[model samples]
Target chain A: MDDNLMNKLAILAEGAKYDVSCSSSGVERLNNGKGIGNARGWGICHTWSADGRCVSLLKLLMTNSCVYDCSYCVNRLSNDVPRASMSPEEIAMLTMEFYRRNYIEGLFLSSAIEKTPDDTMEKMYRTLDLLRNVHQYNGYIHIKAIPGASSDLIRNCGYLADRMSVNIELPSRESLKLLAPQKSFEKIMPPIENIRNNILLYKDERKSFKKTPKFVPGGQSTQVIIGATPDTDRSILSVSEKLYSDYGLKRVYYSAYMPVNEGPNLPSLFSAPPLLREHRLYQADWLLRFYDFSVKELFAGNSSSIDSNLDPKLNWALNNLHLFPVEINKAPLEMLIRVPGIGHISASRIIRERRVNFLDFERLKKTGCVFLKAKYFVTCKGKYDGESLDSEFIRRKLLNKMDYQQISFLG
Target chain B: MMDYLYDGTFEGLLTCLYYNFAKIKATGIYRTDTYQTSLVNPHVAITTKEQLADKMYEKIRKHLGTYTLTDLYYCFLSEKDGFENILLSFIDLCFRNGPVYAGYHTHKEVIPFDDIVGKVKREVQRYVGYVRFKAVGDVLYSEINPEFFILPMLASHFADRYFNEKIIIHDAGRSLALISKDGKHFIMPYTETDLPGSEKEDHITNLWKEYFQHIAIEGRINLKLQRNFVPLKYRKDLVEFSKPK
Candidate 1:
């Protein structure tokens, strides 16, 4: 019996690996003494896989069997791969055992459609229900909202899960039609919209009635496959920005498309994945979320992609050099963070340190700001540390410090 | 220059701080166990006094706030060579210049103090996830080999997490263990013995090893990046990194 379960686990985990949304953050739940686990607001990663991605949750699928055929998916109906499904009891047992041993933070449960969309959704819901109610597990759970599932079933799953996400697999509608022909914006967008509305309503209700159950307290997120289509970085980031502003998303994961099945519409199987481009997109995503940069600000000119050599923030600094040399001692928090090397942590540290003492060049270095890059952009106590304020000279100096060899396709 | 020696404990270090403030100024502070004899300087053995240490603790908390006190405690836990002198000088600077000096990250005395504290805190965070347990009868047992004395820091996090399970987290490097059961937890000195050999292979452990390998994308196999997060030192205790016998 155990051998059978292990085989199913290996198959289901392989099927779910491509979805790439394993974060267990944005929720803080304490174990109620009788339960087995609790969650921290800033999540913990149990271990990292060989690919260097954080294994914060036990990422697995309910079943590898599917009805729909998406060309990019390994578990699509037409693919000849090992097929298996785990009973809800088996999934709950594995999650509890792994979580008890500290092998994972929680369960990241997603599934390919075994039959209809509702059938897959119901099985996922049952697994969450068993873990939550039967096993009394209080750890983090991130579940996927299968597109075209019934609204009531999705709502029930949201209450048991910490986070819910609907994967907008392809960025553009045109790509969606050509690649994942069965899926569309019409099926994908509604569940995300419903989740956003319900999260707001539940939060407001909890304010009035403290006993009201939390509905997806970690908020919702989505993933988009990059390099699968010709979608520009501008368009991709704009979609993320709109999701943040409109849907109030917690995060938007961008997975570089890995060619699994050979198809006319897909990239050639032998071609390398666009790892560098994906890294650049993630950098821009961080700027949008924390550094107060807009999608428009990232791509200022006719260029459709972010600069390959420099990071988005440094690239932005090079384009808008007139804004520098920002005085470290007197610049506001907003302007200070925009400096090339000063991150949100260092920017706030500078603010606090300046309140007690006047920051000089030596003092600024001690605040943990990256002096190699920030020296060209920021002036400490009105002293310019760089040789010249010219953008070209500064860019050349900054590029020299970066290790260009690490920017290969495999990286 | 006078060298003061005390028992290696946070309370003992605080008493040394009390002596520096109220009694006599010392050039060097050393833990009693790790102190080396010096012909040039006269040594003073400062016994750990609960009253004196409590007074200094209250003074630091009242003036410097709880956060600064916590940082000082973390630094003491690091048990690094010459950390006692660094802590003394940092406390002296903070007291002389008021509480604002604690936030002076660029200051000479604050820099080394913050660095030691950061290492200790980071180790605590890493162990929170890296700790892997195996069921031995009713108790869940795990072992860790960390550079610093971080068992005290990890106590509350695991106690709240595994409140219902009888868990023992053994720190083999320091001969300490955090034992939690019945909704309460405490740290004490413990020595471990080898478990009796079981003929049967554990199925769950095998399943976790399989899942770890299957999760990584075959095309994006970067052992360099993997080692960056899970360093060579930590791989010994991790279940997935261990080769199956």
Candidate 2:
């Protein structure tokens, strides 16, 4: 490659590194035989970063030059950082080159508002158009939906991209106004809601036609910058709950606020990022999506913040001591999944495996349950392990067994 | 007590099971290659008969569905120590209870077989993600040193993914290779010298290595997480971990 292209790539990739949404799953598009690449149902992580995040796509920005000056962004317009912008053709060529080398699954193109939101969005749309129509690249492409861009431009970009995201960087409208004055939830929520309605509409169209082009088949996701503002966990999750219920979002990403720029509105550089809180929110999100958990169940009586020592599921189990000692052999599938030690897959396995025989402790252990943690709350063959139903002792025992400080990237 | 022994092929195992089921009152069954020799007990070598193996397999498929039988076959592929005895006992239970034993997860005899099958399936699934292909000339070549005999299991996956290109997946651990061309694939006994690196292969490999090193975040360096995802055992064949040729 030429020196100009290389310089642009280095700056653009570095600028896009902290977005933390490089996933390439939830859509399976077969290569049209003429196309160069295909998207698998389960996304392939070509490699991992040193931080252990999966690098599935060539995640990069179209340009770092911006018109809006967000306080938390590295590519804020007022910053003195080096700025470079790739033309739509240059970005398309780079994606094809990287993809052919098997360096990435596809493209994750996000950009700062260079001239205006519509101007920046049109540049991104042209990049996607060239990749899809001109280059015939049929791989996974995730693009950012510029919050203030026109509905027509957003709809056009949604047609060509596999997934679209509009980041709710700050939790509340007040935070958006105070820090990111140019952006607001009014501008952000409209585009997200539009994509959701269009995706549903396109699904209905394709049911009869059978050849209609997919409109954001992977669905839309939004990211919230946690710990940047004074928003509580309850408030954050409530927004997520509303997003899921009203907008039908596929995912809501939580990014622990990594201090990037210094401003009076932003958090101090000395404070650590809330990595543990982000992880707990993800665990809670999984519960909502797969484990049939309601938002009210988590914050029903006293707590809004997730317990740091135990996982969200275990924490909930310990607090509701009246619901303990659930019978493993006879508990329904929904109740079984609510158990701390039994995950979605294992709970299903238990349901499947228990049909033919009466389940005992050994059988439950063999079914992939976290047998040690589960022994306290579950009874097999009417026999429980703990001497008493003392919640504090059980909590302490679990804490002694698990080191909550050590976080797994699997979460 | 009598001991029945046979070669370690699946057919050999089936033949041994057949003999114990029909001809002999054997106390224990063993694969002759893996079992230690002992002068205390009398051991008889059982020759594999294709017809008898076929009959035993038919009986198994009749008692349990093909899904359960495939699970048992995967357990056999695991090649772990004393897996033959476990298979024999599992098959015996299948015959006695006529499908209840296979369905019942809590049965003492069924749990060990379930464990082995689960282990084999997990290894197979991991290799699906862990297998990395290096471009050598027109063929996309990858070499794996998987713990299980998983080359056969990986045939349909790679074939579907790379339908237009010729591909070869070599299992270096077992000296086996599954080669596909024109959308068709099959496995054969392979040696080290079968694959010849293309001229530009080194350049592409270096490019991949460059991308791998630069992609990791400097602020959040977690070797523990990296090791957890790409285990040290399978890193030998991975392009990021391997030294350039």
lDDT agreement of model 2 with the native? 0.81
| Lowest-sum lDDT 10-residue window in model 2 chain B | B199-208
Per-residue lDDT value at A166 in model 2: 95
Native-to-model Cα distance after best TM-score fit, residue B170 in candidate 2, in Å: 2.5
B1-245: candidate 1 lDDT, tens digit per residue: 58889988788888888888898888889977888888898989999999999999999999999999999999999989999889989999999999988988888888999999999999998999999998877788999999899888988889899989999999998888999997689888989846443322277888899999899998888888888888899888899999988
Candidate 2 docking quality: incorrect, acceptable, medium or high: acceptable
lDDT of 2 by residue, A303-346 (tens): 67887667888878887889989999899988899888999878
Each candidate: what lDDT? 0.89, 0.81
**How good is the docking of model 1, as DockQ?**
0.78
- Model 1, residue A86: C-alpha shift (Å): 0.6
Question: Model 2 residue A389 lDDT?
Answer: 71
State candidate 1's TM-score. 0.97
Candidate 1 on A288-365: residue-level lDDT in tens?
999899988888787888887888999998888889899888899999989988999999989888868899888888
Off by over 4 Å in 2: A2-7, A29-32, A87-103, A129-138, A400-411, B1-63, B98-108, B192-207, B243-245
